[model samples]
Target: MLTTGNDTVLSKRATKTANTDEFLLTQFEKAEANLFHAKDNPEGIVNMGTAVNRVMEVELIERLTKPDALRFEQRYMHYFNNSGLLELRQAVADTLTRHLAPDNPVSPDNLAIMNGAGSCLDALAYTLCDPGDVVLTPTPVYTRIFTDIEERGQVDVMPIVCKAVPDNAEESFRLYKETVEDKILETQSAGRRVRALILVNPNNPLGDIYPPGLLLDIMKICAKYAIHFISNELYSLSIFDEDANFQSVLSFKDIPDPERTHFIWSMSKDFALAGFRTGVIHTCSSSVMKCLGKIALYQCTPSLIQHASATLLSDKAWCDDFYLKINRQRLRDRYSCCLARFRGAGITVRKAKAGLFIWFDLGPYLRSRTKEDEMDLFQEILKRGVYIVPGTQLYCEEPGWFRASFAVSEVELEEGLKRIQQVVEERKQKGQVSWSTY
Candidate 1:
């Protein structure tokens, strides 16, 4: 038996968190890490890095926290439901069915509700992967996927590198179906089992939606290899572009392998209720559902939250007409505002259609086409009173790309844009030119 003294004797998984980017960010010495807290800190940190829907708070709050929100009869609830309340699960199932699978009814029995999507991913990771199993995902993804899937699960997350499209007309860092299969085959040849592939629809950082055909092709590839395909449609209803088509994996008429295909969604992104901490996992495999149910005990959302979320989701008319519609319009307006500002400043921002952020090329500002230069630029902007996540942190192959959230209050967004403009001007005056060759 190992001596359980200090953290030095902790499990390897626990020790891994010590060196994680989350840990490093919390330990930043320049300022208190809780700079975003409104209370004690009079000096506000302009947060353009956090991936959240900060567009409409009053409406969401009013809608979710009304007097009838929580069933008062449920106040005495003290028992644990590992798979969550059937009512909540039913609500989610109904909502999903209404949105993505109107033809086929989504059974509540096939769903498992947990605390937020991050925890759901963590549970799924353990349910499917072993200590050395591999999970493939695209580059410049939401960084937390690494922490959620690998920290405890001990899964190796390999990036499927995508080359940047030189032409403005083409999408950047495009994910090809063939490349995914090739990568899986390559990983197998190297003697590691590819247990899973993660697809973030309306992708984080990129904010682009995958066409339905592409999603089906990818699902077929996963089906062929008998690997788990985890589709995180967290921002499914957050589509801001009128022309962009957003298709949930459930929208497929014929699922390639219902047992292998799974999906995750959360109130955190779509409903702008990260505080509620509600996540749902839908799987057709009864065995997978059993595995998830067993593990979900450790990651269950509170009964109160579950009840409240159920009440919120069950109101389909309000969600469709008021909340989702308003949310999309706000996101569109904010995205347009940010896009116009960047273009006005001659910054080449990859056009985004959905999600809360824009992947912008800061190659022009980097002193050299290097990660170090990227960090230098990042630090300079942070000092100028704005926070944006550098692409290096998101595991992008190339440096000088940055993920910036346009989902902020108008005042805050303008302030952040001003600070960014200042930094860009400062860099330009100092002779920093676009290193397109990188």
Candidate 2:
């Protein structure tokens, strides 16, 4: 009922939105196609390139063993029927109590395990977003957030533009709150119902580490508006910089209504088990979660992922170690690499606070060429051996923006930057960057 049909819910104010091959799945798809023939070519930096394999090299391998986890691990027993073991959800509650809140403890009854944060998004969207609802969010959000929201044409979208926070990732939490309120008011005046607000900690494209004060601002705004506050904390534990990491919105026990705010997080990013594909959605609201359950009835998580997720989720010690590893692996130095190179070339980029990505401004480069021509130039970058996510692909009017991940090793990261620099030089020389594509 919440499906968007084929109509994409962009923005009501903007007539033209910029989308380039860089932002879409083109580079990844292209590299994948290139791989079909070169099957023997050991997976190289030609893909998401940010070192998803970092987890593979983790020293903890001896602890997991070669059998139970990879092949014969019995964690697969819980499958689709796992409403989620009480103990696993309790682990999340325990983490919240230990790290964010002590007064209010979350119980298993408040949590449910889904396929991934994306699944939780679908369930929440289905539950709260009816036909023609509007999802209020910020720009340059995770690309899937848009596709998932727009997938069900029921809700139109309103993107509140966030300003660059320079070096403070946690500082943007306050910025996001203030801007979202402004955008929500704008839409309310236009006669559109603002159904919910979605947030990604450390952000998806920008990787901004939002501070605690900012999160309180968001919690206050959401509580005041009576709108559903959907927090995607999947990357919450990936805070590479400690000073930048703050308590999550879910940490606020005084939340006006426990049920009004919902949380989505997983062991994927933190545990380096993305391939494991199971995640948890927790909320104190019984009614809202009840509605979410109906949607889950349609597409349950695979049994195997559920079992593995439980193994890691039940152990409290594993939770601490997981967060520690992610925080340690999160590299802020990548900011220095891309910015030094790009800014030196006159390209403006935003500062990345946490997580593995950095978003670059390309408006200066998009001044020439048609949409298709721009795609061609983007494809050329793939030939250079470094792949990136384009801004337009993330659904924003801004041109000349792309994302790079730094989860790779120091060597691979340096090499990727060199390739990107080489390609930037080629584009600048040929005057190939295009802006008219939107």
Residue 431, candidate 1: Cα error in Å is 1.2
Model 2 lDDT per residue over 26-135, tens place: 55565556541124553444554332434334534543553444344455553434456454566666765665566666677777777676667777777777877888
Model 1 regions lying over 4 Å from their true place = 1-8, 23-43, 74-76, 167-169
State the weakest 10-residue window (summed lDDT) of model 2: 13-22
List, in order, the clash count of every candidate structure: 0, 21
Q: What is the TM-score of each candidate against the true structure?
A: 0.94, 0.79
Q: What's the CA RMSD of model 1 in angstroms?
A: 2.7
| CA deviation > 4 Å runs, candidate 2 | 1-26, 35-45, 49-82, 99-103, 163-178, 314-323, 330-347, 365-377, 409-411, 428-438
The Cα local distance difference test for each model comes to 0.85, 0.63
Best by lDDT: 1
